[model samples]
Target: MSGDYSIYTGQKRTFTIPDYVLFSLTLAISAGIGLFFAIKDRNNVTSKEYHLGGKNMNILPVAMSLLVTFLSALTLLGTPVEMYNYSTMFWWLCLAFVSAMVLASVVFTPFFYNLQVTSVFQYLELRFSKPVRLLASFIYILQTCTYMSFVLYAPSLALNAVTGFHLWGSVAAVGIVVTLYTALGGMKAVLWANTFQALVIMAGLMAVLIQGSIVTGGFQNAWDIAGNRSRIYFHDFSFDPTTRHSFWSVVIGGSFFWTSLYGINQAQVQKALSCPSVSKAQIAFFVSLPGLILIVSLCCMIGIVMYAFYADCHPMDFNNLITTSDQLLPFFVMDILGHVPGLPGVFVSSLFSGSLSTISSSLNALGAIIPRDIMKPYCCPNISDRSITILSKVIVFMFGGVAIGLAVLASQLGSVMQSSYSVYSVLNGPLFGLFILGMFFPWANAWGALGGALTSLAFMSWIGFGAFANKVSTAKLSPVFTHGCNWSVTTTAMTVTTTLRTTTSFTGSTEVTTIAAPSYPFIPMYKLSYLFYMPTAMAVLVIVGLFVSLITGCRDPKTMDPRLICPLFDRLFPCMPEMILRPLRCGVNHKGNIRNKVYEEADELPEKIQPIDANGVEVKPPHDTEAGVLKGGAINQGFEPIDAKTPGSEECITHL
Candidate 1:
């Protein structure tokens, strides 16, 4: 009992004046950005300006914003823990980011940039039906709300270790401030604030690396010590699907995970569409690749460096200060830099920087989506522009409150990195598939898309959630005791402090191993690696979607608007054989393929659709639910009548 008490004492390090000042500065700057934008666009703020920075944002800041938004506090706190506990093999995920970004640049960016829509899910309604769009949007809102809670909770776990601040207090502080900024400045403030926060994230990481190296001799010493303990490793070339960190899993599964986020997710797509043109959006998308790789590499390096610093005497085993991998980085920061006034605060600020950037973007994107996809189309189709803008701000505040409430309920989970990725892979997989079906398979009707999504969701929920619940254990690293570090093991009130740490042969250790009876077995599918969730979900959705479309009498591919299909599909239809492409397009004459002229050229804008009432007075369609394409009156049985001037209708189809 006394030995464990000593461990708690070591962890009770408090922050000084300089530490508080540095942390306060980061929050103040974030709030100030919101104030600047609010004052600048006070009277003229419209839905476009609030949601997309009036579609005139610069390419560089927008790129940085996208990078930081996805790579949140989860990466900063959770990633290093991944390295320390397992091996450095997770570094290969940076390659996954590269592949995902390349795909986004070639395919999704051009489509969204040209569409001129506020929400990315609006593409769902345009391609499929209203229920599909609403389903996708609702999934996004639920996943992001759950994800933001984790983002807020991850950093707070670290904050509590060093500052003695209550965990709930930290969660509330981060969540409330992020909510305020997103509601006040809207999109512009979120973008600019993310740019500044990105720099802070880099600086906080660099400070730890530089100071850690200096305190522990040099980089060479840290590298050699960490390597001696098998910490620096990256050559796992296994093909087994159930293996957690194999090369195939990280490259293929990781790429799919990233693609789901960047390619189809509104949080990222919203920023990509804010640029002036498709070309600029593509440029911004590419720029984020290098920055992402740099930060992830720094995080990986920090993990190895941490192992070197306390290789021989891990605090968890000795001080009992941290039980899970998530707390390891915080333990190291407070232990090493606690004496150096503001340095610990800087590291904490980095965590907040990540959380603030992610939560702000998430809230703003949620605000945009709730109105554009759900409220505008169904509840208030004729809502004025000013009212829509006001409603967006209200949604931001409402969702932000929900995230805080969820964060308060969070407790210790398994590895933070895996916990986050597991949740992402489960929800994002089917959503990404819905977009692919719409773009690549024109014969796919609304019913097929909806059925595919619902089917994938049910299967993944059972397998993914079950696999997650069973794994309550975390992996431990081999300990390597650093010089000058000392710990004492006590039995019956006997204590001896020394620099030597050995797993075996401690006097009166009182440690005993226990073995429990095996529990019920998981089927092979449930036993598969969490990384496979995205690819599996996507495959199920596409396969089921295609089968359903065929059996239910799919629409003719020839009638599909060329704008709805990919440029590659439209141009190569003549050369490609019938068997290679789906049988849905078999009836269409290859020579009669009408190439979408808009995608063929680097045009400035997409063809706009304007609806009019019977009196010839121009009117905007009520909600996306009313504007979607319907088939045989199947799902739209009792819905309101759609305007003929809508884009998916016959009259506007030729113009599209």
Candidate 2:
């Protein structure tokens, strides 16, 4: 009764034993390699060292880690299904890259760099309340828990369906292994493993693509078939709120999504921010842009190739196929290609890497968030760093446990694989909105932050639910020529010349299966293109929060806590750098700006902070619980960057 059961019973013949064994081994090995790294880096690094890699990490692995975070078992298994079912999202990933990298470099990275923060949620506490911070952290934990489970469970289902192993067993082995290494090694370990796994995933797909091409034809043949028959639907510029994949939805929604990811998402944010220098982190953003284009494009081509290969032996029912849609990729690999020994192992390892990298990053982040956001603020305000580190390890177990447990009944999400992004999008837009408000708008009060998040959440839920029901009511679209199609996650390269079109005109003798729920939702959710959900959510948040801030006009408290501010910001945001040109500038927290650090020496004026049209808000801006929107920053109030000696000798704190 799990979410995706439709896949198994009817598609059993297509999924075989060899596939399951290959899939399981990948998860087991990924976990083992991660643990060894954890132990090696154990003593010298603290939890900060463990989780954030002591901020001394390199960029190659960092950028790769980001790439793996976005890709997962879903990409491995479901992408080809998308290729089979509709327009393959080959370039869909490219769209994500253009938007992701630009935002990270131009705007998003600088915001974090300016602040010098560890957790994205921590920014909320500085401007708002502990409650706001905790809410965000809780939402993240919920997001990752559900997300990681499905990530792990997806390949498990693929393994079981192909190899006929129990789903729960697959979930347990992968879950335990990923969690163990993540708990031990922290962020560095996760990134290193991510680098390893990313390679494995790419290698696996290359194998499938190469063998599949020969089985089907050559590149030229695939091009002929795809060009002649396949509907690549590269760009659908006709914009309609109801339509799933369109240019506006991609460009606009994508912009918002990347902004939130780079700016607000804790797991993704930590990896880049963890870098010792700001320049390295910024480079991480640039590195992935090209990679995104290459890999995603290759994936869709592989899908077409799969279709061509199986033109003859043609497995499962076309419309009658019972498996959840995402399972298509796995079904192909196991049932069609599992006959090759090393190939299966490579495929499964790649699948495991995608899931492992993302989940491990999440677990490491949860460790940081729990102590910083909830546990320390409310319960143990003064808990030592060591205690905090120990507690984070415990949280990793909990995060993994819940995800694995849910994985057992994963069939409930109907399309647990696709729903992964939706789960995140639904919450992220609003959550990130709150933070956006804080960073940009000094006037945004705690109450506004709380209200903005609540409102955004409500709006997203309503739309999300409607979309889900629409998916339920609509009819499932299947290929017209049923004889050629087979059932498995990524298997579909048949090249018969039937016009690939679907129309819901079932009449007399047909027994119509209820259309599987929209795999997501339809409430102007705009087709099943939930890919842009987070950015869409972010849009709603920023707009709504800003409007509200204008109405209310409240402001963030001027006073800061001793521990709330990081030492890094003081140097960067010089009006508050505590240390001067000496060794004192090292890692120490400071309250005032470096400029302000002149400490009562210069008769200075406290600058007026222009209100921010801050980050995100629900349906309206919440910048003004204390109240505000976009305006000049606090430093703009008559302050200019001055060398220490000139300002010091003159005893002049000019508000320039």
Candidate 3:
């Protein structure tokens, strides 16, 4: 057999002419959007315009982009497999989605919108120091790179299962198309592409759900079978730190996870920032919530439908499914929708669309951050805007190349959803922590932020990697009971070696052994579910950061930029004794009592910084020459008030 012949011996259908045509059409539409915008707006292309979509993007497209970016192929494919293998506990994360959006809107959104920074890390520099900004930016870059590789890998693996397409070919095809459009059309192209792709994703998912339900008789029948088989457990109320996917973990820990992504990660934040106003951006966040919940719920239901269809004979038996659990979604689609001609293609296109939308957003965001954050400061300090724009496109191509290259070497890392989230929770916690400390704690200093971030990262690396290495074995929860379809199904147990023969097509193994050598001893903390990593690391960061700030001496609040602190904090704790507060207090009404005693001694004070006036214009500071320049240059460079009474404003460089 070229790869594995066992899985395809029966009536299973592969890709056909109509299927390929449909898939090609989907790709063409995406590229067409990019080409249309590239030619249409070529004349007015500027760094600000390209990177932020002229900072006037509508709320609907921005909302769709946010939803699609999070609902990538990782969620589309991996989620069903998660529900199939474990249970529906993952779906409850929708609750976390609500909390995350509320926090993002109430706490993080106003600050980012008000500050008007292209790279959100610029806020870190404004709040703490240059090193903190760079560290936070680098951490974000690392997280995206790692996540994008798997995002590209996932749907390709699915396509390979059904059509036998080479994994590397799928990777290159998707990567090149995403890069082409992202480089050519920029944020507008990305946003509109996401809007179209999001629709495709929903259509494909509904098609699968309806078809699978038909095959299983009805939705209620599928639910009954799934319930009987125990594939629908959602009430894990454990508070034990090690328990995976509990009520608290999914709700509380999930909030931090989603917040890190939506609140701090530049990819999602860039979409939100593209909107014309803070209220519009907040509207986008709110608009995304319903779609996010609906899509994930559908994915979870698909898992249940799969369980019902194979109730009598699970895919694990009889070369039953594709090589890995992730492949089951594709296999199920083929079984259910193969005879429908272009329908299978639609499903596959949706998978590809999911991958394309996410990778494109990451590429565009990476492009924006490079010249703005990394390259301009170190490589060419005085680089012109034209050079910077060119550099951004180059960085997109470079990172797209890296992600594709990594896709070739990538292998299945357990269930796709778990692997991606585990990686996210472990690495992104510190990045999120830096933002939290910056916005929430006025006393937090550079050493504290840096110290806490590094410590959390180190601890998570040890525990997270250790846990991945010493993989835990869980008992299969679902009892095998196929709905008695009598068309040559097998339920006999396969020996480990025989199972490996079929699995090697996707799992890339020829011989599997039941017992393997242990690489690392199990540790109690490492055994804790990956969901807890973010909240735990965040706690460590806050506790450690506050302690270090107190001991090391915090920056004076009056000397700190009021713009860098969260508006929620300003509104909530407007006053506290100066002895208890950090010595600096920049935004307080009592500035005259403390202003000159502090700001005059601050380093690199700007000659002048015009705070935003009631009319939304940058007016000259009430007092001149004493304001310290925020570490990063004026954050709201691209956004200037278009007209008086337009409610348009630039973020002021708050000088203490």
Whose lDDT is greatest here? 1
Most accurate candidate by TM-score: 1
Cα lDDT listed for each candidate: 0.74, 0.60, 0.73
Better of 1 and 3 by lDDT: 1
The predicted structure with the larger TM-score, 1 or 2, is 1
Looking at candidate 2, the ten consecutive residues that score lowest on lDDT are 625-634
Model 2 Cα lDDT, one tens digit per residue, 496-541: 2322212222222233223354344323343535755665565566
- Clash count per candidate: 7, 82, 11
* Ranked candidates (lDDT, high to low): 1, 3, 2
Q: How well does candidate 1 match the true structure in TM-score terms?
A: 0.85
lDDT, candidate 3, residue 175?
A: 88
Tell me the tens digit of each residue's lDDT in model 3 across 227-270: 65566787779888766678998888888898888887898888
Q: Which stretches of candidate 3 lie over 4 Å from their true place?
A: 1-9, 479-522, 569-656
Q: Candidate 3 — worst ten consecutive residues by lDDT sum?
A: 496-505
Superposition error at 596 for model 2 (Å): 13
